[model samples]
Every structure is written in C-alpha cells, then in structure tokens.
Target: MKQITVGVDASSESRAAVRWAGAEATRRQQPLHLVHLWLTHGRTAQAIPHEEALLRAAQRLLQEAEADVRARFPGVRVTSELVTADSPDALVTTGGDPAHNDLLVLGSQGLGAVPGYLLGSVGLHTVAHAGCPVALVRGAEDPARLGDGPGPVAIGVSTRPGHEPVLEFAFSTAARYGTPLLAVHAASRHPALIGRDELEHHAAADHDAEQFHETLRPWRDRFPAVHVVEHLSHGSPARAVLDVAPGAGLLVVGRGHHAALGPRIGPVAHAAIHHALCPVVTVPHG
Candidate 1:
C-alpha cells in the first residue's frame, strides 16, 4: 500500500494536482495527504489577517479541496494540514518525516508566468530534493479519463547503465496498479548494427534490443505480476521518453549520479518534469 501526498497551494494547478492525487489514491486504495504551507510574510489580501484567522483560512481551503477530492474518490482516505511557514512542499515531504509517506505529488506551473497557477519553484525544489519518490502532475489531457485509472508505468533504464532505484519504484508501482511495467533503455547515440545486409543489420539491432530486455529479468521476477516490457530505443532518451509519455499511467525515471556526487540526474530529471504528459516520478539513488 503506497501512502501518497500532494502539496496544495489553493491554486488551480495545485488543485489539479490534488484531483489527480485523489484519483490515484483511490485506485491504489491509499490515503491522500493534502498539505498546505503558509508563509507569514506576503503581499496578498489575506496577509494582514490575524494569525489565527490566517491559519483558519488555510485550513478551510484545504477542507474545501478535501471535500472535492472525497466527492470524486470516496475510497481515498483524505488528510489535510496547514503548516505555518514557507516550507510548504518540504513540510509535507518525506525528507522531513520519512516514516509516514511513500510518494509526493505536486503541480506544474505554480511558477509559470501565465496568469493561471502552475508548478512553482517549491514544487521543482521538492521534486529535485525529496527523500522519497516525487510525482509532478499537471492535470490530465482528458478529465473524463482520470477515472480510467493507472495504466502501464514506464521505467527508463540504460543498456550500459543500471538504475536499481528506478527499477524498484517501477516494480512497486506496477504491482500497486496491477498494471504492466515497461523498461526502456534509450540510447543517446545510435551506432548501426554490424552487418553487410540491411535485413541482417536490422536483425542485429533487434537482437540488441532483446538483450536490453533480458537484463531486466531479475527485477521482473521480483514482481511476477509486474508485466515487464522492454524497448531499445535510439535518439535522445529524455525526448523519446517524453514522446511516449502520453499513454503511460505514470512515468518513472532514476535521479542518480552517473558518478556519485556528480550531477547527471538533475538535468535529465528536470527535463522530464518540464515535458512529460503524465505524472513523472523521480527516484533518487546514492
């Protein structure tokens, strides 16, 4: 049972995130924790209110959001909180209270220049820095299909590089969703397979793709119902993953250094956050 949390800021984007979280929580039969972090200093009209009243206002906002969530996902156990400070996302993050949470969900565009709310800096910082799996959701392409529930969860692995953390999360999510897990090892540089004939070369490439798939066998065994699938794709890994992101129920990517203490995962994870159509999960590695 995955315990999921979504950061809520009373913005449309955050609400969208809450709706997505509520539905996912229902599908997983998990609790939905709606967190709101309020800062004392602000330029908003509510800034001048009595501190007690401000807190009440925040609570009311979360309660309203909770009602909406409950209306849509009656099965989801909804919890609301109003933490006073700027640590909105962090307060709800597993980094602060690791024992209670399995995942963190946030909205995209809370920082976008557009008049509408989107993923803000807090959401980005939390995703990059959270202790547990973090998901960035920006609503759905089809609101009607939100009830369609989770589908195949995609995990990106490299033929030459291993992403154990990513594999673990993907397997766990697949098992939770009762859906399939697709392991993709996308090659950034494409080197034609060695063969004199076109058909033979294509066969070699396909064989290499199968090898990539075979590498994930050990993990697939851990999750018998995981329904493992594989792909050996060429072109930019990030772009390819994003291109196929739409149909996925959830996308899982590893956030680990190619070299420990190095910074490879940050940029790739950033790209995925900004582009993926479905909720993107980033699993950090040591």
Candidate 2:
C-alpha cells in the first residue's frame, strides 16, 4: 500500500512534520513511514567510537519518533527506518519513489531573518527533485489546527495546460477534508490597458474570470462534492496566493518542469513553501 513518508530528526521542526504526516496518514487511512538518516559517508563497517555513538543516537531518535507517532495516533500504522547515507539523497530516493510513497512530508525551519521564509538546502533539493508531491510543515504550526479547523484548501490555479496533477491533488484534498477549495488565479495587467477607462478595466477582469472558470470546469465536474470558490486578482501570483494562505488550512501549488533546466519549483510554489501560513504542498507537473 502507498504510504505517507516523513523525515524525522531530533529537531522540533521534524517532530512537527511527524505530527502533520501522522495526522494525514490517519485521515487517509494509510500507513506512515518515518525515516532518519545518519550520514556515514559510506563507511558503514568498522566505525570509530564517535561514529558508533552517533549511529546509536540516530537509531534512538528514529525509535523515539516512531513511538511518538504511535502514541499520538494509535490507529495509524507506523514504521521507521534508519539509513546511512547522505540526507538529501536518502530522503529523495525513499520518499520520491512513486510506487511505494504517496506523499513526502518534511520539517521546515523558517529562515530566521525573515518571518516566514522556510527553504533550507535539503528542503529545496528534495522538493525540486522529488518525483511525488512534497509537503512542507512549519515547526510553529499545530497539527491539531489542521485536523480540526475549517479553513479551506487553497490552490494556485494556472490557466496553462499540464497542471492536471495539481488540480487533482487540490480537489481531492478538499473533498477528503470536506472543506472549500479556493482556486486563485492572478493575471498580470495588460500593457494595452494603460490609461484605460473603468469600463475597459472591468471588461478585462471579466475576461480573466471567464478563463479561470473555464480552466476549473472539468475539475468541478470531477469533484462535485468539493465547493470551489474562484478568486481572481491582479499583480503577482505569489502575492495573491499568500494573501489567502493565512486563512487556509493547506496550500497547493504546481512545480513546473523546464525542458532545458529540468524540474523546478516556480515562484508561486517557492513563495507558498517559504511563507504560507498553512502547510504547503508542491505537486510536480509538466
């Protein structure tokens, strides 16, 4: 069965991620897999005293994390593994495997200089390279808030094609949680509209709204149970999505793939992961 995979460590942020992933697994009725990595630099045999001690500590941390998840969410089937490899490589390989894992959850330590910025090297690397969807949970967030709150699941809608994965994930999540799906699309102001009349501005907004509705029509049909609220705004897409994120339970954005540059998290997904108040899920799509 596909499981929800989470990276665990001794940090408070990792604990928060465990809680979030545990809650998610319970809700989805799926098993949860906790992973802890001990960087051995490929020296697994005949380790020195300090290295051996560190290995023991890593094992203990994984055990403690597993115990905590089992205690907090008894119904959730929990399993754990200790891997001796590079942190980012191990996490990406384990959690990014589409055959076994459904989602990858990671702890996010917000950049301290900025209030909500949350991309560290490991998170950035994993999110960028992971084959499956990745969810970033902040240390300060309470899992209970996500479990019990009624905040809608917000998604940054793209009119462009090839975003079916993002749409499907957002709609399914909202359906599962029984919450509204706020579909937000921000259109840049057309240069032709410079010094335009009020009537022209209104017409432009109406055009954008129609396009947004057209993009969502198929999803609305597919997820009839989900209540979708269409939100059209002007200016930066990232800023528009962030504005609604403070009140959302979860934010879903698409990770774009560049033919030349390979898989990349776009500005909107980047902003959501770094600064969204709610847990941000970046769904990969080309």
What lDDT does the true structure give each of the candidates? 0.71, 0.87
The pairs that clash in candidate 1 are: 108-118, 108-119, 109-118, 109-119, 110-118, 110-119, 110-120, 111-119, 111-120
Residues 1-286 of candidate 1: C-alpha lDDT, one tens digit per residue? 4578887776666777788777778767788888787765454665565767767778888989999888988888888886666554545454224467777777776335564343566665666567677777765434566677577898777555556777788888889888887777765343554436688666666776777777688777788877777766775777667766766888888776546555334655766777776778888766
Q: Tally clashes: model 1.
A: 9
- Worst 10-residue lDDT window for candidate 1 reads 89-98
| Candidate 2 lDDT by residue in tens digits, 1-286 | 8999998888878888999998899889999999886665656466665786887889999989999888889999999998777556787899887789899999988558777668677789889999999999888887566446446899999998899999999999999889999999998578899998989988988988999999999999999999999889786999989988987989999998999999888899988888886788999998
Model 2: colliding residue pairs = none
As a whole number from 0 to 100, the lDDT of residue 118 in candidate 1 is: 38
Collision count of model 2: 0
Q: Model 1, residue 229: displacement in angstroms?
A: 3.0
lDDT of 1 at 193: 43
lDDT of 2: 0.87
Which RMSD does model 2 reach against the true structure?
2.5
